[model samples]
Target: MTAFGISAFGAYVPRLRLDRAIIADAHRWAMPGLRSAAKGSRAFANWDEDAITMAVEAARDALADRDLSKVAALRLASTSLPFADLQNAAIVARAIDAPHQIASSDVAGSQRAGTSALLQALKGTQAELVIGSDHPSAKPASVQELTF
Candidate 1:
C-alpha cells in the first residue's frame, strides 16, 4: 500500500491576546469561580479576522516553499464558520489561490469537527490539506466566553 502522511504543517495565532484576568474580572460578580482560572491569556481575532481568514493564513504557512498544485483536497474544520449558506472551505481555497478543481469541504457542528477532518484526510488517497480554525464567540458571563 502507498504511504500517506503529512509532509508539512503550520499554524496561525492572532496577534492580539486578551488576558484571562480581564475576562474574569469582567464577570467575577456572576461567576466567582472564574477568578482562579485567570492566569493566562487567550488569542483574540481582530474584527476583520474569521475562521476562513485564519485557516487561509495557516494553509499558506503550511504551503510555504511548497507547490500548491499538489493539494487535491481541502478540509476546513470549525465550529464558528462565517457563512451558513455558502461553502466555507471554498473561501479558504480561493484565498490561498489553490487549484480551481481542488475538492473543498467544511467540517463543523460539533467539537469533533477538527479531529474528524484529520482522520478523513489521513485515510484519503489524495494530497489533502486539513485545517482547523475557530473563532469562538460566546455570551457574556458564560463558561464558554471565559474559557474561549
Candidate 2:
C-alpha cells in the first residue's frame, strides 16, 4: 500500500475583518443575542471574491515555494460557489496556471465539503491540492447575516 500525505500547505485570509460589534449594533433590536459574539471578527470577502478567486489565491500561497508541475489534481470545496452549473475547480486550476493535464473537481453543498475533499485527496495516487472557501450572503438584520 502507498501512503498519501500533504507535502506542502498554505492558507489565506481576507484582509478585511468585520467586527462582530457592528452586526450586533445593527440588529440588536431584532436579535439581542448577537452581542454575545461581538468579541471577535469575521473574515470579509471583497466584492470581487468568489470561491474560485479565493481558492486561486490560497492555491498560489500553497504553491509559492513549490513546483506547480508536481500537482496532479486540484479540488475546490465551498458552500458559496458563484456558479451553480460551472466548473469551479477548473477555473481555480486555470487561474493558478496549473498544468493542462491536471485533474480538477469541486466538492460542495455543505460544511463537510472541505473535510470530505481532503480525505478524498489523501486517497488519490498523486499529489492533490484541495482548497476551501466561502462567501456567504444573507439578508440584512437577520441572524444568518451575523453568523455567516
Candidate 3:
C-alpha cells in the first residue's frame, strides 16, 4: 500500500527553548551525569501547552488545506497523556472538528506506541491521523529536571 501514505504534515514547537547547558550548570554539582546529555536545547512547553493542546496544534496543521472527510480515525500516541480518565484522541478529534463518528484511541506507555498505532492503521482502509505529543515534567532540582 505504498500509495496509502501521508499526504500532508504539520508540527508545532514551543517558542520557549531551554538550553541544555542551563540544566547542566544548575545541576551538574549534584548530578554531574547530566552534562553528557546537555548539549542541545529542548522544547519546553508553556503553561498552556499540554499534550492535548499540542496535538491539536499539529492536527490543525495536518488538516489545513486538506480534506479531512476521509479520515476514519484519530490515534494519539504519548507517554504522558493529560487526563487519566479522559480519552486524549477524542479531545484532539473534537478540536479538529472531525465527525462525531470518527474513531479515536490512545497508544501510550511504550516507546513504540506510534509504530504500533501506525501498524494497526495500515491494516485499515481509511486514512488515520496519528499524533505524538509529550510534556514530561519534574520537580525542582530533581534528576528529572535535568533529564526532561
| CA lDDT, every model vs. true structure | 0.91, 0.85, 0.84
Any idea what lDDT model 3 has?
0.84
User: How close to the true structure is residue 100 of candidate 1, measured as C-alpha lDDT?
Assistant: 100
Please give, for residues 95-129, the per-residue lDDT of candidate 3 as tens digits. 88999999999999997887888788888878889
Could you tally the backbone clashes for each prediction? 0, 0, 0
Candidate 2 residue runs with Cα over 4 Å from true position: 1-3, 142-144
Clashes of 2: 0
Candidate order by decreasing TM-score: 1, 2, 3
TM-scores for every predicted model: 0.91, 0.88, 0.85
lDDT of 2: 0.85
lDDT of 2 by residue, 1-148 (tens): 7556877777888888888789889888888887876777778788888777778888898888788898888889999899888888998888888999999988998899999999999877888899988887888776676667
Which model, 1 or 3, shows the larger lDDT?
Answer: 1
| Every candidate's CA RMSD | 1.6, 2.0, 2.5
Give stretches of model 3 more than 4 Å off.
Answer: 138-148
Error of 1 at 48 (Å): 1.3
